[model samples]
Target: MMLYYIYDGTFEGLLTAIYDAYYERENPELIVAMDNFTDNFLIQRRYIDTDEKKATKVHNGIINKISEDALTNIMYAYLSEHENAGKYILEYLRFGFKVGRLVDSYLSDDRVHNIHKLARKVSRERHLLLGIIRFRLLSNNIYYAPIDTQYNTACLLGDHFAARMADQIFVIHDVKRNYGVFYDKSKWFISDIDTKGNLDLHEKELFYQELWKKYFESTTIKDRLNPKLQSHFMPKRYWKYLVEMK
Candidate 1:
């Protein structure tokens, strides 16, 4: 009979499940996130809670035994939120432990390739948002920027902006997840946000937005429109946060 290991839908929980799997000497057929788990009479299931100690142990194993890049790939895969992502992460880690740093060179292997592929997608999104993310000054002097991403990438995006804009107080709200990074000049932290309604903008913010829109309009030549090419570079979904689109 195949065994299934289930965990709460968190990175820590997933790491704990990995720790349990190795400790028990069991190669579970599935390492499923609870949000994606389904009951099956044929398969035995065990649920694992998020344990910081266990998660840290597994994280240390990955970093010390495998490679730092492997840990990065695991994080990116977790953020991918793809179907059976937990299972894939476990499989990748198991393979990584055996091969050490060379696990990344196994491009022909489906499991290794998938991890790389998912991580690439996440890296690509993070890179795009770094350039396109726009911030507006709030009524209370906070720089606020709201983004809706298909991948759970706000945390990664937050880290990038925090380093670049370390001197400014800002909020990078992930509207889809109802959470944001609150940066207070000295440091940045993630927290839940109240996204119930539209935020009130500063009076000057409105003026700058209008000025930006005008600049975008004035620079464009109607005769040279290439929407297909433009859409290739800038997907239509991201236009919602763009000042020019407003």
Candidate 2:
């Protein structure tokens, strides 16, 4: 019989389910988010609550027993939010606990391979967004940048921007996910924003954007233009957010 551990669609919740699976000694066929779980009487499903203590125990256990990098890999995989991401992380951690730090090195195994791929995918998007994100000055004197990303990467961008633009008030909004990271001069945090109306940009921001677009146009030589090569470096999916591209 296939038993599914259904969690509250949170990382901690998923970890708590893993903790239950470990202590209860029940092998769940799949650990699914509540939103993903279907209503079916034939399926044996257990709803796991987000328990901080149990989740922390599993979190610390992974760090102390396995490698710190293993924990990071798990975080990235979870942030990937792929349908099978939770399942992959559970299997990856199970293997990591048994073999210690060398868990990721055994990528030849499918359990190890899938988690690593998801982590890499999220990391790659984070890296690209760091370069591609364009911030505009707003009427409230805040720097606002909106992005539409495939993965949940808005939260991952805080530390990088917080350090780079230390003195500025900025918000990196993931419009697709409808959440963003707010960075003050001192720290950064994530929250939702009101995106119902048009953005009120500073008068100078429009001038700056136009200037940037003109500069790009002036520098371009039609004879030497290679859009394919340009898009190779800067993916077409992100062009919609770029001032010059617009």
Candidate 3:
């Protein structure tokens, strides 16, 4: 029987699923997000909601079994939402279980190398967004930034902003994911904000957005314009949240 483990699309959820599968002694043919489910009678699948306590235990176990860097790499790969991420994670976990502390050397193996490569790509994008994401100050003294990312990375991007913008109140919305991070000087929290509803923007914010749009247009050289090249650099999907693109 081909068992399928379906989970909520969160790092903790994935880890919980991994723990459950291992404890159950079942090798899942596939592990997929709940949202991606397509009912098929031939498959024996089970959906699991994330259990924080179990996830924490599993996370601690992995850290104890492998180096902290290995744990980071696995989490990064999980956040990427890339195809084959589940399979790669399973492979990595298997290697870690076998070698206990020497799993890092498995980086020399082709299977582990591919997983690390994908994890690095996702990590780089999350890091870049930390510096590149622009925020507009509203009249209420709250800063707002809307972002559309290829990877489900709003949570990943929040840590950097929370640390850097410690003195100000700000929110960074991942329009693609319909979730955002809101941070005040004292505390930071993550929540789902509806993007379809009225977006609160002040006149000053609108002016800044207009100026950014104008600047983007002005900087572009029509003579050298290559839509394909531009798309390659900044994917069109991200244009929706970009102030300059608007």
Candidate 4:
């Protein structure tokens, strides 16, 4: 029977699971999220509860022993929210602890390569979202933008927007995840947001939306229209939030 470790799907929980994997010597075939676990007669499942101390110890060790960039890559991979992200992080750490900072140089190794691939995917989405995200003026005077992303990237955008729009109050909501990063002009943090009907747009925002749609139509060259190439660059998935795409 193959052993599998399961956790609550948080980054800290994943680190705690790794701590157990190392200290208990439970050589599991996979590290999986509790919600994603599949019951199988041939697999032995071990549940790992999130412990801050143990998680912190492992987090510190990764930074102290391995490179800080390794931790950043691991965090990016974790934010990917991919099914295999936890497993890849475990394998990456196992190899990293042995080779120290030089572990990143082993791109030929599948363990190292898997993490880099996930991180790159997440980084790409973050960069793209920064350009494509559109904010609307809220009735409460806050700026709000809703996004549905492949990876967990709403929180990743907090720093960039906060720096650029320092004097503005805004919220970047991740529709799929049901959470947001809110900025109050001075500080920002990730927290649960009310997604109900209360988020009414400011009166002028509706006019602005209409104006943007008109601008899009007016600027288009009908004779040279190429949706295939447009979709390739803009991606169809992001159109849901685009006011002009409506």
Clashes of each: 0, 0, 0, 0
Question: 37-91, model 4: which lDDT tens digit per residue?
Answer: 9898998988899999999999999999998999999999999988888889988
Clashing pairs in 3: none
TM-score of 2: 0.93
Question: Judged by TM-score relative to the true structure, which candidate is superior, 1 or 4?
Answer: 4
Question: How do the residues 99-204 of candidate 1 rate in per-residue lDDT, one tens digit apiece?
Answer: 9989999998987988998999898988888988899998888999989887888899767787899888999999888999899998888999987757789989
All candidates in order of lDDT, best leading: 4, 2, 1, 3
What TM-score does model 4 achieve against the real structure? 0.94
> What is candidate 2's lDDT per residue for 141-197, written digit by digit as tens?
899999988788888999999999999999999998788899988999999888886
Q: Using TM-score as the measure, which candidate wins?
A: 4
Write model 3 residue lDDT over 146-209, tens digit each, in one string. 8878777778876778888899999998877888899988878899997665656767887777
Off by over 4 Å in 1: 1-3, 38-44
Model 3 ranges with Cα > 4 A deviation: 108-110, 210-232
* TM-scores for every predicted model: 0.92, 0.93, 0.84, 0.94
* Better structure of 3 and 4 per lDDT: 4
Q: Of the candidates numbered 2 and 4, which has the greater TM-score value? A: 4
Worst 10 residues of 3 by lDDT: 194-203
